[model samples]
Target: MTQPRIVLYSALLCPFAHRARIALKASGAVYETVEIDLKNKPAWYAPNINPASKVPAISYGAPPDSDVTKPPAGTFLLPESALVVQFIASLYPQIDYKDPIIRAKASFAQLQWDNLVAGRWRKYQFEGSEQDLEPLLEGLKQFSDSVPEEILGDEYGVADIILGPFVTRLFIFANEDIGKWAPGSGPKLVSALSGPEYDKLRKLGAKLDKWPALQETIDNDILVKKFTEILKNH
Candidate 1:
């Protein structure tokens, strides 16, 4: 079977873009990547590729071009990380959900995490106070407990791909660097999240350690360094 031609527009440091990239890789589909500079987006990118001018946009089943409004016949343009990941998963049989019910459940779970848990983490990371740490810790514990033992039994699927990137960032960067970046509140926040009270969350962290695809996605040294630099400046 001929593989669909895919071009991924992405920035390495964006976790959302990273999620789409992971899905693409795990699908075992051959696709080209065009890294976009988020700081200085090209003039043609917004008009031609994605109106939102975001990384992790994809042009499917066709070569990349300057048509902004729509893709060529036999192809389509998809933006947004979660939607792009779902589209690729559906297109390729290799990484698709084994059961429709499970797919629905996982999709719903992913949405909840994205909207609620991830939002809380972001709030704690950027504008959290000492009083805010307890809620964030509680949220992390709830999130970890809510996740299925493997999410899809023995197979890696969409839900894992969707949440894996942000989970990695939270444990690695947020836990470690929050103190240095945010001062007094930082260390306390990290301790509360990673401390004994949240061992379930730590166990979830261990699961991510064993996920090879996630490791590959989050282990980029250059990406990590760049993200750390950004956080330090934040």
Candidate 2:
């Protein structure tokens, strides 16, 4: 059997792209990464790869040197972050996609996390309005409180893969350098959310702490450095 080749176009800071990259890593499938310049996107992504011009697009095939057009048999471009993660998870079913029920549960968990980030957490980042982040913090608090211990498994799964990027972003935004991005009520927002529930999430992620592969992905300071370089070039 020919080794399946997976190519990922991604940016380090992008949570969406982060999902695809981490999912691919967790799947233990060999893949090549093409770090996209999100500030100035390449032309190939506009029409062929992703019409929306998103950062993360997975192509399974040879590199620029090869002639193969189509990807490996049974392979297709998975675009959206949530879908991309699910697709990679499905590829290596033996790892975590053990049974139908587990698969469904994991999918549900992924969607829930997506919703929480999109609806609540993102508002604090993108929206620079009154800067009253109490609502946002409360929403995340609810999210953490709702999760039970059973879900935070000993082995890594979609639960950690989906949340890691956003969690890291939140931590960075709360830190000294990036804290200004939050402004007026951001400190309160961070304080409120970084509670017992937040600890639970961290505890869940503890298994990831020792894993070099996972650490390499969520290295927040490294991402800050990368983003700094990107900003300069732009």
Candidate 3:
């Protein structure tokens, strides 16, 4: 089958967009990226690209009478990072949910982690107070044990793609003593993950460090500095 022309609308600092970036790279899909300025989104983006005016929106497939310079009138535009990641995963057999039973299991597993684990971690990173450390610690501990060795056993799959960006950020924030990143939780989470209790999570961290696509994204010094500046201002 001929592959569709894919164009990704993305922002460098968005964690959600980072998910799409990782999936697109891992899938080995040929795609173009249109970097959007979240602060001042382009005039033509809304209603035409993504109604939500969000980054990580994708323009996919070619129209019946496709024009080389423009997406087809029938080009499919999809928004939301999770759905986009799932769509890309569904396209590539090597990294997708191949069987119905496994697909169902993976979906449920990812949903559980999203609700019970990733959501809490996000809260701790953004809105957590000093008083929130204990619960956050407990949550991280449980999450470490709960995350599968690789979201899909041996290969990086949808679950891993969805969680990879956030995990990379967590590892960065936890390890660095960024004075104001997260008052108590940041350092404490680092100490906890480094300790014997989170051996499994430490191993996962090691695996992430070695993941080529993720490492490439994480190693973008400019983007890292940009995000760090945002954190400093926060």
lDDT of 1 by residue, 83-197 (tens): 8987887776667677777777667666657666777777777666556666766677666555655463557788778887877777666545642334556555557666665
Model 3 clashing residue pairs (backbone): none
Give lDDT tens digits, candidate 3, residues 1-234. 768888888888788998898899989988878889998987778767887888789989865355423465788888999999988877876767566766665566556567666766666666666655566667667666665543524566776677677767777766664334355656777876787666756666667677887776555566557756876677
Q: Cα miss at 91, model 2 (Å)?
A: 1.3
Estimate the Cα RMSD of every predicted model relative to the unseen true structure.
3.3, 4.0, 3.1
**Which regions of candidate 3 fall more than 4 Å away from where they truly are?**
63-70, 97-109, 150-154, 179-185
Model 1 CA lDDT for position 116: 61
Show the lowest summed lDDT stretch of 10 residues, model 3: 63-72
CA lDDT, every model vs. true structure: 0.72, 0.64, 0.72
TM-scores of the candidates are 0.83, 0.77, 0.83
Candidate 1 differs from the real structure by a C-alpha RMSD in angstroms, to one decimal, of: 3.3
| Strongest candidate by TM-score | 3
RMSD of 2: 4.0
